[model samples]
Target: SVDLWKEAAMLVPEYFENTIDIWEECDVHWSPDLEFDQAADPAGAYADLSSDMTKSNSYRSWRKQLRDFIYRDVTLPLWQDETSDLYSTPEETESGFRMRVVQAIREQNDLEVEKLKAKFKSKFESQRDRVLRAEEKVKREEAQYKEKSYMSLVSIGSSILGALMGRKIASQTNVSKGATAIRSASRAAAEKADIQLAEDKLEQEQAKLKELEIEFDAEVEKLEQRIAPDSIKLEEYPIRPRKSDINVADVALLWMPFAIHANGAKEALFTINE
Candidate 1:
């Protein structure tokens, strides 16, 4: 087991040297006092590490890369199936471990996304209903206004004809011209004021309807932007496991080699597992 571990450590630089530029001297250390479980849970370890990482400022630069290494690159003999060889290469274990982590992350992300979509959908439905109701109210009011205006026009015409007939009759009977003029002006002013009031009421209702429609449109646009398939990037989603989801008993602490290099002004770290 010691010889195999040494061989695995030596092979690490060969695979990652171009990308990670490792130091020539590699050290191995183990703590016999610490109790390690027979099998390690990578996802649980990821969750534990994530919780710790968020609380500390350390490893900020290489946090994502570290997580990728644990999920996609790391391979332990304890993690292999009983039917499989005890000493499989990293390449042999990579695909299975990567698939497991990917599936877990994707499932969690999908759940959260569905919840988000449902919330948005509910809001959209509510807004749509409100818009529909407003539209109906506006239509009803418009129809009533048209009907009332038509009746008002007919009444005004009749009133005008009656006033003219009354004036003609009064003039023939030698009634006072001033008195007739005063009565006609009063009725005309009252009718004009009623028509203006009705028009103002209709205009207010129309304005309210327009405002509602605008709000509905805005809601639709927001929903589209939020729940669009193309707009969702799985990589961007925070699909990490919660602290409570991880069991401390399942975690194993292991020391792995990491290479630090300067890329322009920024420093980056890369790691490989044995």
Candidate 2:
């Protein structure tokens, strides 16, 4: 008795018959319990064998003949209705569709980049203006502080010189220390204290300005990072395939039958149509 084995069916596209031309081999498996009566020792026969069809010349010739029949004799039906959505037009070739997809992607990327650049420009200008204003304020304050400090020092020096002169004149005239002399000395000491306080305040103001400058630089650096070319990636935007880009005519499950003999001889029973 000849035992029939069912193999998994292969899915073939009714369209693009040329795509199937690359098949060079086929796998044929025999059942473990099947006995080869033609073998000298039937018990030791190839009960479970997975054979490559191209390994034998007979199998190769048989596969070639079947392939020739498929190419020459087989007739695959296509959709005949002109209004069917499954039918592809001449202008809708794969290459043309690919070019259109690329163009669409490029346009989208350019638009996104322009929007990003505009946003970055606005932020950068705002930050730059803030820094400029802070710089101007600091400069103005420095100039004012320098002028005020110069006048204060001059006045303090003049007051101290007048107090010394008064003391010297009093000593020369043999006059005892009086309230007028004490008042002049007190005023001069107060002026010196005021100068020291002013210098301390100036140092504090300078330090605050330095901190502001550092903060401004950090803000600029952050803005620069946002506008960097590498920061934007095209892969972040994924373009999905459009429905019109894909057209499926038909799907088929084809079963092919093959027989392997005890001496490694193989045969295909029918053409692809079977």
Candidate 3:
């Protein structure tokens, strides 16, 4: 097969550097004995392989040979619109390859959680501080109230003392007027006391009258007792004898006639019978 790569390079030497690199990477992947690079794309690897491009003179010559062979024998059959495995390897990340990506995602979530925790911590501290400040303010207000209440009580006490002192000074300064008022007050008090005393005297007089009335009644009762009749016993009266009307002469004379007739008749009858 004719190597059109060399002819194409001769015609367009400006693209030789890139085309030569593509050839080098493909020769390394698919060795001389193998007919096809069915599994590897050296063109794709040329863009990303880790190699010192400056020291690849011998590698470049061998790559040119493989490139010439591939362009004439294989690539000429494929169109410009068609994709080839030799030019492109699919970019795929297996589950085994995803370890780094998962690590990055987990790190991001951890960072977000840490930030949220920090934000919440800050908010909590702010709220706690507000509560503490409010408590302090309440304590301050309570202290002020207690102080005010104490001051008010002291002022009231002072006012009362001042009033009492003023009254005493006025009373002492105007002796004549105060004396008259005092006498009037004393008179009123005395009247109340006199009323109480009079009530006591009246109660004592009533008690004496009650005692005299009780004594008079007792004396009257004694007089009545003396005039009342005494009770007599029934045994003190003699029992009356019962009188019968039958006389002793009536009984004896009546029985004496019968006695005389009975004796005479019996003696005559007996003398006849004998």
C-alpha RMSD for every candidate: 18.5, 16.8, 76.4
lDDT of 1 by residue, 1-274 (tens): 3122212122222222233422222232222233335554453322123343343333343344343443343333423322111223333454454344444445655676576667566666665565566666556656655665566555655555665877664453334444554555555555556556656665666666566657656655554453433443322111233333322222123433233336634232333333
Q: Residue 236 lDDT in model 1?
A: 15
Instruction: Tell me the TM-score of model 3.
Output: 0.23
- How good is model 2 by TM-score? 0.32
- Could you tell me the lDDT of residue 154 within candidate 3? 56
The residue ranges of model 2 lying beyond 4 angstroms of the native Cα positions read 1-103, 168-274
Q: Which ranges in model 3 have alpha carbons more than 4 Å from their true place?
A: 1-108, 168-274
Clashes in model 2: which pairs? none
Could you estimate the TM-score for every candidate? 0.33, 0.32, 0.23
List, residue by residue over 1-274, the lDDT tens digit for candidate 2.
1122222222322223223442223222222232222323333333332243224644454446444533443322222121112232332454443444444444555666566666566655655565565556556555655665565556556555665777664453323334444455565555556556555655665565566556656655554444333442222111222333222222222333446689988675444322
Error of 2 at 77 (Å): 18
Q: Can you rank all candidates by TM-score, best first?
A: 1, 2, 3
Query: Which ten contiguous residues of candidate 2 have the minimum total lDDT?
Result: 76-85
Candidate lDDT scores, in order, read 0.43, 0.44, 0.38
In angstroms, the error of model 2 at 226 is: 17
- State the displacement of the C-alpha of residue 36, model 3, in Å, after optimal TM-score superposition: 35
Evaluated with TM-score, which candidate comes out highest?
1
* lDDT by residue for model 3 (1-274), tens: 2222211211111123445444333212211232223444333322233333344564556445544544433322211111111111112223322333344444555565566556556555655565555555555555555555555555555544654667763554445444544555555555555555555555555555566556645644543443222311111111221223111111000000111254564211111110
Reference-based lDDT, residue 184, model 1: 56
**Count of backbone clashes, every candidate in sequence:** 0, 0, 0
